[model samples]
Target: MTEASGDVRLTGISKTYGSFTAVHPLDLTVPQGSFYALLGASGCGKTTTLRMIAGLEEPSSGTVCLGEQDVTALPPYKRPVNTVFQSYALFPHLDIFENVAFGLRRRGIKSVKKQVGDMLDLVQLGEQARKKPHQLSGGQQQRVAVARALINHPKVLLLDEPLGALDLKLRRQMQLELKRIQTEVGITFVHVTHDQEEAMTMADTVAVMNGGRVEQQGAPAELYENPRTTFVANFLGTSNFIAAEVDSVSGDDVVLRAGDGKLLLPKARCGAATSPGGKVLLGVRPEKITLTHADDAGTVPDGRNRITGRVVASSFIGVSTQYVIERPLCDAFEVYAQNIERDTRLTPGADVVLHWNPAHTFGLDAGQDVQAGVEKVEEDA
Candidate 1:
């Protein structure tokens, strides 16, 4: 390994079959010793991109670099990378310890007892070393696969939906376990996942892919808080978009007209090209807005946006109550109010006002689809 050994870089990387392009030409750099996630729905080319890096599928054009070395033409075994797939491809006949040691033994490293033992302990499977694949739980089997890959000390560890097989509770546990292991090993981890929450929970950097291209790439917090595209805003989490006209732009602030009310948005936080009289999509997260009785709209604090609407529906989700408000500008605006102190009066069919600080609002291009990546209507608020 060189000084830049752990970094993975793809320059002008793309994949095509006959006529259909899977991965469009793009450049991405995964930093050294950081956990990176390629997040997208199926057929979005996330898996194809990963395969290109792993040398399983050759790119139609471009170069794959592991640190300073160009590994584009290198075979899977030749490249300093290892992959763990969703299916735990463990040898049924081999016990957990032997399965983990298989890779080392194949490389002709005979002194593997200590190394294999340490790895088993690292995955918290030391006691199950002698158990066969069938005897171990799904999570245990997955951990064994992880131990097997990590024992090789690859420059980059690629995990393609590695936790997709486990049940909900087990999947959540494995997510934390994988993060802890990555932190301890300090190897560059490039993860592929469709679950937004899973990607956000485990990855230090997340690249949201759509239409065979990366829509956005940044820290999970950065991307969630300041998404630049409609796809990103909708895919990462729920966003209530209201079509509004740009009222004016002054310094860093931009005012917009929604229905008969006005919304103040910060220009720095918006990606839409805004000028006076132009159209833009104003977005607010469900958790960022507050819901109160419609009669109390005038009591909202100065500088906060207030929109009155009739509550079409409300659902209690333990920690919070989600409300769907029918507004004039858009079909519905979603609001989430914490249940620390529930308001019994704010029920379905009740008129209410949604209010939030100006700083929490963002804007996007109005010409784009209002429901670009939204999964379902009437599911959330």
Candidate 2:
């Protein structure tokens, strides 16, 4: 074995039981000094994959590589990785300082004063050094767990839903703090999570797994903007898909006939093969659409993909108002309009027009189940 270079490489890694498969054979790479997330719903094999890398769960096939060293047969203690789980697992009898110094003391390092002090300060828990684990707040205790894990200075840190125990607000705050810590420490951080927002806000790269397979992997923004599958579009966020047929192929644009209206889609944005009369699904995020009262429909700008519908419901959600419109082909056409101008007439039983820039629309293969990811996150959220 060579010195660990801090990169985690998995080639054809898989996990299986007697008859059921947890993680299918897949290849993944976590570059040195990067934050990577494996995101998926419960029972989606994300946890199994993380455990395999930690040596807690053995892979049915393939090898686990830490940099150039293959540590497939090594025990968890021998691998150059420390895992921070949802449970802090701190020793209740020890103070914060001693808790972080436990790893060093176990290794027979006699003098642990400077090392423990520095670790506490690194995690901003220097002031809480004398406090016991049971006495600290949930967030503070979590920090102690992280400090303890980092004190070992492992080549990689594996986090398994470390923010699961935190409330929504605290979880969000921790997301930024973890990202800050990762940047400061500059080591490979492989995080496994079911929360889409947590993964999006923290990880530099995210691999979305489903049904024992990795559906897609990319930057959060990249995945959000150009999802190749309906499952990805709906799972990451909400997407309103409109059924359409290719009217013709114009210069750099694909003319689509959606219901009674003609829509234009960018050639590059279409993720499906297009031919004259071929069916496709035109997808647009709710926030990308502008909803206007039918009485004021004429004011909508030109060169925009437009749809005529009736307001079925409306909701005010603090920053923006979400409207559900009933339209041809698709009944629940959703739109999120910023609270810029109040339109009192845009209510249930009111006529409305939904419009958005054509460039914001993406075309998907019509054969895919449009509801593939709809409500799937609710299972774990």
Candidate 3:
């Protein structure tokens, strides 16, 4: 593995509880001072990996290195890492200043008052220094917890779903706050979250984990635009995956036939062999698809892929219209059209045509195994 400056390296790291494997052999490198996120659904080993890096849990095998130090066997307090847990984990009996000062006091640091004051000011909690944990709101209590962790000047700050307990508005606010704090302090932050939007918005890099291992790691846009695996494409956002067979290959672009008798030309350049009848998968984002009335006699749009379907459902979402269209050969495909002030909402039973730019289509191998146990849960209707 390539070693970057100020990087935290984990090589062949694994964790087990009795007979159950919590984290499979994992290799990861978090560059120094970068906001990195470990993202996955619950039980996907993201939390376990964060704990291992925080020194709260030891690896069953392999090594953990911080910068130039090997701290695999070090205890939480002994390692140069501090954690802000989901619950804030503040001391209820102590005021903001005292709680933030707790870590420094434990280390017998002199002039603890000045250090606490500085840390409190750092988090904009200087005026609330006298307030107890119960006297503060959820967001305030979270800031106190952050202050407490940072007072010790740890090299890496591990946050395990720290914003999970807040409401949507507060969570969004804190996400920006957390990113700003990281920038001002220039400390490495390794955050664990199952929220794709949260990870994409706050972290400099994202590692998508699944089934006890990281499936893909890259910048948010990189993962969103050029997903390496079907799991990454599906997990990051809404996508329409259509089964296809490669008809021909021209340099990087491959012409494939969708299961529904529609020809698809993908934008991706793949190394996979494409024989005349070889099968593949075509992935297109919901937002990339355009819906038109079935009888519209436009120029067929000169697209490499087009399919006719019946609109099964349509919902207005203020700025966009989401349509669920039933295709003849593939599963129901979803498309989102921008409102643009034109009344384009189709009736539920109306016939429609779905067309998308070939540049938006991506091709991948057809037979990759889907990660089954870590699927994200949809909100109740």
Q: Give the candidate number with the greatest TM-score.
A: 1
For residues 1-381, could you state the per-residue lDDT of candidate 2 as single tens digits?
233489899989999999999999999999889999999888999999999999999999999999988999999999999999999899999998899999999999999999999878877889999999988988888889998999899999999999999988888888998898899988889999988999999999999999889999999999998889998998899999989999999998999998778999999999987899999999999999988888888899989999888998999998999999998778498888889887889989999888999989999999999988776334654
Minimal lDDT window, size 10, model 1: 372-381
Clashes of each: 0, 0, 0
> What lDDT, from 0 to 1, does candidate 2 have?
0.91
Instruction: Report the error of model 3 at residue 214, Å.
Output: 0.9
Candidate 3 minimal-lDDT segment of 10 residues: 368-377
Q: List the residue pairs that clash in candidate 2.
A: none
- In the predicted model 1, the residue pairs found to clash are none
RMSD of each: 2.2, 2.1, 2.8
Cα displacement (Å) at residue 70, model 3: 0.9
Q: Candidate 2 — which residues are off by over 4 angstroms?
A: 1-4, 376-381
Q: Estimated TM-score per prediction?
A: 0.97, 0.96, 0.92
Candidate 3 C-alpha error for residue 309, in Å:
1.0
